[model samples]
Target chain A: MPALRLALHFIHRELRNRYLGSFSGGLWALFQPLIQLAVYSFVFVYVFKAKVPGANAPGYIPFLVMGLWPWNAFAEGLARATTAIQDNAALIGKVALPREVLVFSAVAANFLLQGIGFCAIVIAMRVFGVPVDLFALPLALLGFVQLFVLALGFAFLFAAVQVFVRDLSSALPQLLMLWMFSSPVFFARDALPERYRGWLDWNPFTYYTEFFRAALLGAGSFSLSSTLMALGVAVIVFTLGYAIFRRLNPYFEDFL
Target chain B: MQSPVLVEARRLGKTYPKVFHRRDRLRALYRLLTGGPGIDSTSVLRDVDLEVRAGQSLGLIGENGAGKSTLLKLIVGVLTPSSGEVHVHGRVGALLELGAGFHPEYTGRDNIALSAALYGLNADEARAKLPEIIDFADIGAYIDEPVKHYSSGMVVRLGFAIVAALRPDLLITDEVLAVGDESFQKKCVRWMEDYLDGGGTLILVSHSMYHVQKLCRQACWIKQGAVAASGDVFEVTQAYLAYQERKSAAQPVRQDSPSHAQEFYLIDLALNGDTADVPLVIDQGCRVGARVHVHSRDGREPVISFGVARADGTSVYGVSTEMEKQRPLRVSENVYTVEIEFPELALLPGSYLLRAHALDTEGVRLFNTLVRSITIRGESREFGLIRLKHSWPAANSETNVAP
Candidate 1:
């Protein structure tokens, strides 16, 4: 609880310091992803005429929203977390504290913003007459936790590397963009070629998206086998990231 | 039972990889991960051993880049030593760098809580100490303002305030007093005195010997990453001061006459009548006399100039025989002897250079310079280059006497 309180204070400071000065302020947190979703919708709905396997054109927006919101949270969390140590180099070089607090606070701030955006998207889905299963909310929340754990794993790995290699901060966003496309953020998994569809089994985001889609739309490929696989991969990434982070934590002050 | 040692560092050293290219850093990290052969590293600190008992204050004195800060960091566990080990017995509160852990965007009050938490204070304890920290900082309305808006002195004030409130068993401070204003520095010193009186162990790093001698019972002088000297505060500080003077005195400077000055040349320069090869050293309030021997090509009385400067090249005093209208006493046909005696040299304790120049009788045109180094030793802790003759009345004396 004390750790949580400290993380919360850092999260509050991070959020307020970054967005409070802008004209749109905290609204920008919601607006950025909405704009991205709108662009994706325009390209898919009008240009590509993309169709969901179980939903019509009217239901496709909510399907995309369910996947896109979690992806935004995961991607933003990792990106911010990677630079957490570098952003606080001054403090790290001086005082001794749990360096993990820096990475957790950064990820948590973005996660909170994504939660708000997810609520907005769910409300908009209801207005559009799309399915919104209140019973499936717990599953969606689990999917969020899984995403957070995976993002934290990557955050620990990258944040450790970033102290030595500053170029990682610049290169990671492009890598995340590529990763987002590889996952089923915009298109349905069924739409992929049969050869490539097998690769989705390897992509952990694929399972995460399936869980979220199942919770919101009740039409995702979520089964016991897939859930176990998701949990397995989450544990691996978390453990590996945490190990790498702890191993490299000592040399952080040297590089910074 | 004997109290446990508050801090102990045994043969500690910290080596940083000589990282130039990005690949070198990566290779070093890879080595760290795989437990492979280490990449080449330059040791910033080497073979440093220190121990501090409970309620004892140790001062670390060194010039900049001498690894004082690194030692402090290693002891406080902010930095891990590359070799050996550092064991600290209790909770440590360190003010390593001013405003180090503060968030610029957060209010001073908010930063106090955050920093307190970083210092291992729980939520309730941090909240409980907030009012006391605020009162100590006394930044007035600025406490509500963002930290970035606060001045440097205000930041140190807030930082010292937090550390004061924490009252950790071991306190490590690095040059925190060097930045703040005089009164705030005094306040910090007063607080530290009280903290020591309350049985707090302290590790203080500072360039100022006055503070170290005043606060610490033991002192360590680090020179080029090694322990040059360590012992009682007075002995260590004085030895460090003597070493510093000798180092400055050894700075390369042309002491011989120039090759082109053929008309007249200063053959020799001596201080305090000591013509030996060793440097001249004297105590404060003692006479310092410079003897200059000038050889004249044409039997003309050369205008001999005598000047004294501090080691840092600041000219303190200069005089010329031409300006004083004083004639040099002739030692022989062409060799003239001029002795300038400064009765009761008022120079403070520091290294100084005595320069004697041989010029034409007109006190202008070509010349040659001969230099000699001198050191003044004094126990008086006075400031500046000169020891002025003065006295202060008794503290708060009501009597007004005209003597």
Candidate 2:
């Protein structure tokens, strides 16, 4: 977070810049998650009568948020960061700086909005039945560590690739959609077949989403091995991604 | 040494490729699919080397294709050299494009933060400088409004104010000052003077020689992607001016007239001072004489009207003598001579053009003329706008020395 201070400032400026005259105010940040959560909760909890997978699941509402909230946050963060350099062609080409700053800022901004949505769910759980677990609070910090690294990796990869092959921009939504269903969003990860379960084990989002749900549900149930695996993957991907981006980053303005 | 040379560029060059299409769009498609060279990205700058010390101002002057702007981009690192390097020390806050970091949808307050962030300011640091920047920008209530609603002057003022408030070590400014009103331009001049007085370096590029002479101590005049002259401001400007004059005189001026197949018409007209051997300033009001070569259709005298025009191609003053009262004094082919008088010059410190018109002695329409590109240096600042004449005071005022 200390390293990302400049990045976060840029992110805050970017949010204000995009929504400046829209009249939605702070509602601009809360709108997308609220609507998406409401619609999916109706379809799954009401229509399908699905039960919460955790031991002390508050109710359908909190359970529904615990699943889709992280998925949506990761998806939006990746989307913004992926196109960050390409979308800001003017700033990238005209202004002199490290272009990675733009990508980090874009993803960081979307992550903050999603963070707010998660806080709302925690407040709702307190009002209803589920109690707040203080021990789970520190565990949630570990969740963000993974999310931050994942965002950096994807943003760096997409930003470099998008500069050359613009087709990535048009093809991203389909890719993100596929990634969303893979995470334990609408269904529990345990329900999948044993062989199919290995697929979620390797996917980094699995660790983050499951950890987020477990942290909000209660403490002691959170898995340490999965979070550790997530951190390892983040380290490898980010280091490789930064190496590639820095090597190719010099000529971005030339082609742009 | 003198602040240890803040910026240095050696053998810098940039080439932009050009894209062109044939009569068929399919050819464009073929090139697009095949990936071949286009019209742009041609080498605009070649082997340019420069050194800039802190607090040393340099004026960059050049023609449209001379690569002045391309060099600026390279210096600011907006562009990387096709080959070579630009070594810059300390922070470089480039005002290359005014409001370059501004988002149209964002308020002025937001854009200031955005620009500050681009300059490597943290959120808290940007917020700390916000009040000073807002006050300097001085648009009042409009600062809370989106920048799209701001006028060009407001945009320029805000941009200038921000840079001035957060003065960087080396400030690179392009020709952005021509955006505001007269008073605002004055304010900019004062601000620039103060900025320099505070030991800040400024590299300015402007089409106005008045500005260069008034501000820049050293100047570089570029032509044809090369340095034509570089030295003191006045000398470099004079060399640029003299080069333009020589090149213009080398061209054969062609008058573009209606080509509807009319009778014999005029082809070209030129004005020369009677004292061509000894040059004179326009303030002294030299005797302007002209030579006109007329090819007539029939044996008849043609009356001619001549004019002195402003530099913008608008005629300011004109005179025409009576026509055919003295008819039949004519010729068919070859050149003729026309002379005009200017007892006094009535212009300011700028260039002017001379255009001529020809008609029959009876004032019947005959021919139009080709205008010559002319240069007229005005009176020095010691005199007012026009050469109204002046004398030194007997005691020379505060000098306490009498002539």
Candidate 3:
């Protein structure tokens, strides 16, 4: 409880400082993703007539919403985490804390924001009568949690590296943008050519979006094996991220 | 049994890789992995052995980048030593730099809780002490305002207030007193005195030797990543002060005036055998002697005189051989040397200037003047340029009647 309380304090501070304190600042967190959703839905659903492969409906908006929300969380969390140490350079260079707190709190703040976005989307989807599968809700929650852990691992790894190679922070968003496009948020994995779909199978992100589809819309190939595989990848990423982070922890102050 | 040392650092050294390019960092990383020597590096701190027992207060004195802050960081475990280890036995609270741990966007109140948590206080404990911390910081309604809105002095006040409330067994502070206003600084010093009085250990780093002498019993002067000197506060601070004076005075040596050979002139002046090359530092009540060598065109005697003044040029005492009616003995055909000695120098602990002059025989016109700076070093808290030797007489019973 004490640790949780302390973590909550940091989380609260992080949220107020980075997001919710100012009117425009609080608006940005919600507006950014909503804008992204609007743009992507406009281009793919209305313009390209992108089809949902296994949805109860013809439109892809509900399908895209399920996956895009989680991807946004993952991407935003990692982006924030990448600069966790760099952003708190003043604090990191001084007072001693479990430096991981910076990374954890960044991810937590993004998760809270993403969680709110997800609920809002879900309510809208249900109101629109897009077949909501309550049964797969637990699996969807598991997928989101997996994404959080996976992002945390990457956050730890990049947060350490960003201190040394500051270019990584500026470079990450481009890479993440490409990564988001490569994952199947606008189209189903099957919509890609067979060869590209095979490559997508190797991409861990594909499974994350696909898992969310299964949970929310019950419209994707719900493979228990792939779900377990995603879990394995999350654990591996977290471990590797933590290892790199701890190895570089002592050298962090040197660069600063 | 010896009242366990609150902090001990043994052969502590820290070297930062002189990374210039991305390749350099990569190579350093490779070396770290392969156990290879760093290609090029700078030792910011090296072989610093220090200890502070419980109830002992030590001051770290050094010029900027002399590793005083680095050593304190090592002792506080903010930065790990590269070669050796620092063992701190007690809970340590360090103020390495003002607002270092504060989140600028968080209100002062929030940062107090957050910093307390960072300093190892549990949430409940931090909450319990919040009121006291807020009261000590004493910034009023500004406490609820985001820290970025507060002034730098307010930040230090908040940072220091948390440390004060925590009251760690060993307090390590680096120039925390440098930022705040004078009144706040006095408040902090007063609090520190009380902390030390309550049997706490302290390690302070400051450019002000006066504060070092006031608060610390022991001091260390770190120079170029090594312990230049360390011992009693007065001795180490005096040595450091002397070194600074010498470095600043290393400007071009004064050339003899072109007309010196045509008139009576002072060729050289030395204070207790120390020339102008090094500043003189002497303890109060210590013997201070000035030797002046003068030259005369003829074997005619000139009035040799010298005076002591505060660094501000306020004259403390001045005397001339003419006033004493003494004749200078010629050491050579045209050279004369006079020794003016103060068996028990009465100047208090402060920087002062000593000027010796050669005047015409009638003492009406000055021929040449040579000046040297001296520091009277002592641990006394007395004010004034000179320590007057006087004692208070006990009041008689008759005089004790109610006024």
Candidate 4:
């Protein structure tokens, strides 16, 4: 219970840290995603003439919104959580607490904000006659939760490693970018050549983006096997990441 | 009944990996992951055994790089032991460094919440103690301002205030008293005394032997990653002070070799028949005999003076042969010896300097000086430099004493 309380405190602190000095405050959490959605919609729909590869595909804006919000949460969460321990070296050195709380709060704070933005944008698309599945929002949140677990796994792994290898945080942005493009964040998996389409399944993020599109926008069909696979991957990654974190936890102060 | 042991360590040790290059970090990471042999490392602390019971206070005394801080960190669980084990029971409130665990960008109020959380206080409990902590910190409006803009003293005040409010089972502090202002320091010392009186435990690391002696009943002297001495507060601190005095005296003396060109110069000074550079450790109330041999450039008799001063240079007692209308015995043509003895030394237990000076016949001008360190070893709760002889007449009358 204390660890849970500490984690919540840190999550609150993290959320405040993001919007403390900003002009628009927590509104930026909602507006930042909206603006990003606008820009991506412009560049991909208006400029590249990109489209969903199906006859009854949802509008390009809704499809993009469904995937981009989750991708932003995953990428941004990983980026912030990777530096969680390194950024808090001062706190870690002086105070004795569960170090996992720091990484958890970072990833959780990002997911919370983007999760809110994802729901808000979905409802907005529904109001604009885009035919978003309003009744399936809770189901979509389950997929979002699954993605959160996956991101937390990577967060733990990267946060521990970043304490030793300082270059991981520096190189994480480019790596997340490559990971984003490799998944179906901007383009559909079917849009990839037939041979390369199978490779998309290897990226852990591929299931979440495709799942969110299938759940919220009704663009793709959901498969039970894929859901089971995603659940297994999340659990395995979480266990492994947490195991590594616990192993490296005691040594973090030494390295820092 | 004996109190429970609040802290127990068995041959505790800590070492930091020597990561000079990026490649070494990777290698160390690999070694840690694979449970391989340790990477190249420097051991800061090793084989330190310590035990402290509930309601007992222990002072850790050491030089700058002497591993006292590392020992504190290890006990506080901020650092893991590399070789041995340390177990601390109950909640520990630690102020390891000035403004430790404080985010510079966060306001003092916010940091208080963070610290409370780190100490495992729930939100309601933290809220309940907020006003008390802020009041104790007494930084005025700076509580709401970011800690970055506060002075070092403010940071220490805030840190101490939070720890005080926590009222943890065991309080471990490292030199936090040295930073506060005079009144705040008095307040903190008073608070610590009260905390201890309430049966709280304490482990303090400080260079101030005075504070250590005042607050702690036991002391551990660490030297170069090892326990040089550990025992009674008075004894260990005296030993530590003697060691420090010897270290400082080991430096080259400024005075040139005995030169007869001056009007008066000292030939030698002996204490209790011993003439050596190391300090003489003696029990309190022991007879102390001093002999000063002076060289006179001229045949004129010179005045010899002896003075006892606390190690910090506060003069305790000084006397001149001229003051007592006594003259030195002329042992030779130019050499004179003055012997003085205190049948019962009244000085309390602490380190003091015994100085011998040669001055003009009138005792107007000092010519040469020689200093020797003397450490008084005893167990007494008595205060001040010299223990004044007094009698408590009220003890004989039952009515006069409080029931």
Candidate 5:
């Protein structure tokens, strides 16, 4: 119970820390991603004239919005949480509380902020006559939660490893970039060459983007088998990451 | 009967891995993940057995790097022990190092809330205690400023205030009193005294023996990462002080070596019939006898002198044969011997040095000197170098009537 309270406190602090010194404050959380969305929409919709490969496909901006919000939550959460332990070296060295709370709060804070932005954009798109499935928004949130589980898994793994190998945090951005390109964040799985289409199953993040697009924009269909597979992958990754973190937890102070 | 034990450690020890290179950390991680044998490490603390019951105060005293802080950290659960285990059953408030867990970028007020949460206080409980903490810190508007902007003393004041407000079952502090200004230190000491009086337990680490003696009823002296002595506060502190004194006295003793060319040279000095250079240990108030053999180059009688000093070289008493109008007895052509005895030495329990000096026949030119260390061992808590003779009469007696 105390651990839960401590995690809540850290989450509160993490949320405040992002906006503490910035002029935009909480608005920056929404504005930064919207700007990124605009840049992507300008490049993909206007320059390349990209379109979803279906007769009744959603507009490129709506499709991209659906995929980008969840992607941002996952990527940002993983990035922030990966360095959580390393960032709080001062606290960890002096205070004795559950170390996992730092990682948990970092990931939770990002997902929370991005989750709010995701809702705002979806509601705005619906009002603008984009035909967003507002009723499916609840199901889409479930998809976001699954993605969070996966991100937290990776966060725990990377955070623990970052303590021993500090290069992980420095090298994380490039790795995430490569991962973004590999996943179906910018394009649908159908856009890939027919021969490579089936390989999307291999990228754990592919299921999240496709699931979000299907749930929010009603553009794609998700099968029961794929849902089970994604859930299995999230659980297995979470278990593995948590196990490694627990194994290395006792020795963190030595390395720090 | 004693109160319940709030802390117990059985052979608790800690060792830090030797990570000179970055690669070593990775290798250590790999080994730890694989459940392999331990890596190369340096032990900072070893075989420490300690127990503190409720309301008991313990003072930890040692030189720097003696692992006193490490021991406290282990007990406070900040550091994991490499061997054995330590259990602390009650809430602990620790103020270790400067600015202990405070974040530099956060305001002091925010940090206090965070600290309150870390101590397992709910939001309402924390809010209830907020005013008390702020008032005790007494830094005024600086509470809203970033902790990084505050002075070191201000940081300590705030840290101590937070800990004081919590009033945890066990309080562990490491050299926190040394940083604050005089008034703040007095405030902290007063607070600690009141806390102790209210049955709070404490484990304090300090370099100042005075503070240790004042606040702690039991003391543990750590030397080279191990307990050198432990027991009553007075006895342990006295032993530690004596050890320090012997260390300082060990240096600059070359002049004590006898050289025959001098007009007068002291050949030997003995304390309590023990002539060896090793320190003589005696109970407090026991008789102390000093015998000296002086060698005179001229066939003339020499004046002998005996002096007593605290181990740190503070002079306590000195007397010469010239003052007593006595002369040393010549036993040979050029050798003379003199002896003095104190039937009841008034010196208190601690370490002291006894010196025997040889002067010329005129008692003017001091030629040679020899010294020996003597330790008075007892359970006396009286202050200063000697135990004064006095009597406490009954209040009803005529001696109690004032003029």
Candidate 6:
């Protein structure tokens, strides 16, 4: 219970503190998702003239938001979490406490932004003339899974790897760029030729984006089996990431 | 019951592995063919034990690279020990390096939040106490600006202010308190006194004996990765100074044999009126005597050159062959006395060297050179040349002294 409280405590503090110097204040958290939704909707609907997966998909606006917003939560959360321990090197090396709080704080901030993005999605669906249905509620539970797991896994890997290899900082942005492209945001995964499908199965990010778009849009076009495969990848990768992070956490004080 | 040890260490030690990058590290193909770097071992502290209770404050003193900082880091839990263990019970707050971990882009208020969290305070708790910390720091308008604009002294003041306000269960302060001017240093001392009065555990590391002596009752002297001495503040300090004196004099003392040409001999030096150990002080009116040991091939009159010289190569006083009459004496390896009298010696207080030489009556020089130094410690603004002991002129005044 105290851990839950501390997590809330950390989340509130990080957002408010970051907002202190920002011009748009905490609104930037909401604004970022709104802006990305507009850009992706224009590109998919007007520029390319491609139809979204589901026919009653609440139009392209709701479809673009659901897939991209939660995906941002995962990517942004991991980027921040990877650097969490590195940024708090002072606190970790100096004082005695549960050092895990710093990493947990990063995840908490990501969760807060994810919530803001979720609120904006529901509002967008209302304006687009999409009718509410009971099945839409279940999609949230299913849709948001990739956000949490990807964040949890990537955060652990980046934090652990940062201490051993300082060059990770410069290399990470480029690595994220490549990872972002490999996901099916630029093109539909179903259009993949036979040879590329196997490699796409191996790519961890394909699971996060494809499954999320399927759940939120009710796109029966996305195979439920592929979604399960992605979910499986998230679980296995997350466990290994956390194990490596815990094993290396002890000796952090020595090098740092 | 006696106050239990709040901080205890039994053979607490920290060693670091020195990584040796492969010579072929630049060659990617070689590294791919082979592996990574090799490791070498180095120890910062070895087999150390210490105890500090709630009411006790321990002072750590050592020459540079003597493991003082390393021990402090271990006790404060900043660095874990490579072997053994340390048990610290209480909230430990360390002012390890002032202005460390301060974010330059952040304002003073934002940094205060971060600093508080770093010291184990929560956000709401830190915010509740923020006003007092700001007031204590007292850097008025600049407190609202980015910390990058703050001067080094201002940064230290803010760092000290936060620690002073919290008054944690245990405080481990490094030599950073000396970063301020004399007045600021006094303010820090007062804050330390109040903290100590609250029965807080304090571990202080300082090179200044004066500051250490004023603040701490127990002292530990570290030398070459080991505790040289540990006990009462004065005794341990004295032992450390004495050990330093011996270590400095460890240079090989040159052996001189009696010469044939001129009747000359070199003799050991004495400070004050004592002939045993060298006294550590020198001032006006303090007497110095030299007992010379000489041997001559042919019996001849001994002419001596003696002088007290300052550190800068200026001769203060000389009772030499040019000034005084030569005395006929039996010349042998046995001892002879040459005492130069000073009614009142007036000189600035600092370390000075003593020189003595012996020559034959034919005006031929023989042997020269003396001990390394004689240090003088006295009150400030003393008038000099010779120390005159005189009475103030009143009704019974005989004389008024002039330098």
Compare the candidates by DockQ and give the number of the best one: 4
Q: Over the stretch A1-256, how does candidate 3's per-residue lDDT look in tens digits?
A: 4466657777877777776546697768777888988898899877887777653653577788887889889888899889888887787778766788889988988998987778777777788877777566666676778888988988899998888778898999999989988888777887887877788877778888877776777675667788788889989999998988888788888887
> Residue A121 of candidate 3: its Cα lDDT?
70
lDDT by residue (tens digit), candidate 6, A4-59? 55555556667776787789998888888778777777877899886654455456
Candidate 2: tens digits of C-alpha lDDT, residues B158-178: 888777767888888888788
TM-scores for all candidates: the values are 0.85, 0.80, 0.87, 0.94, 0.85, 0.73
B1-403: candidate 5 lDDT, tens digit per residue: 8799999999989999999998898889889989888899999999999999999999999989999989988998878999989999989999988888898889999999999999999999999999999999999999999999999999999999999999999999999899999999989999999999999999999987768878899999999889999999988887897787667556755555677888889988888777877777788889989998888888789999999998668999999999999888888999998899999999987778888888888889988888888888887767788988887674566666786
Which of candidates 1 and 4 is the stronger one according to DockQ? 4
Ranked by lDDT, the better of candidates 1 and 3 is: 1
lDDT of 5 by residue, A126-206 (tens): 899999889998898899899889889999999999999999988999999999999998899889999999988899999
Count of clashing residue pairs in every prediction? 0, 17, 0, 0, 0, 6
Cα displacement (angstroms), candidate 3, residue B301, comes to 10
Which runs in model 3 stand beyond 4 Å of their true positions?
A1-6, A20-22, A25-27, A55-58, B30-39, B122-124, B144-151, B239-265, B270-283, B286-305, B309-343, B348-352, B357-368, B373-385, B394-403
lDDT of each: 0.85, 0.70, 0.83, 0.91, 0.90, 0.68
Worst ten in a row by lDDT for model 6 chain A: A129-138
Best by the TM-score measure:
4
Model 5 chain A weakest lDDT span, ten residues long: A212-221
Q: Give a tens-digit lDDT track for model 4, residues B303-361.
A: 98999999888999999999999999999988899999999999998889898988999
Better of 2 and 3 by TM-score: 3
Native-referenced DockQ of model 2 = 0.34
Summarize candidate 1's per-residue lDDT along A13-75 as a digit string, tens digits: 789867966899998998999899889889898998888886433366777888899999999
Stronger candidate by lDDT (2 vs 6): 2
CA shift at B270, candidate 4, in angstroms? 1.6
Candidate 3, CAPRI quality class derived from DockQ: medium
Per-residue error at B208 for model 4, in Å?
Answer: 2.2
Which ten residues in a row are the worst by lDDT in model 3 chain A?
Answer: A50-59
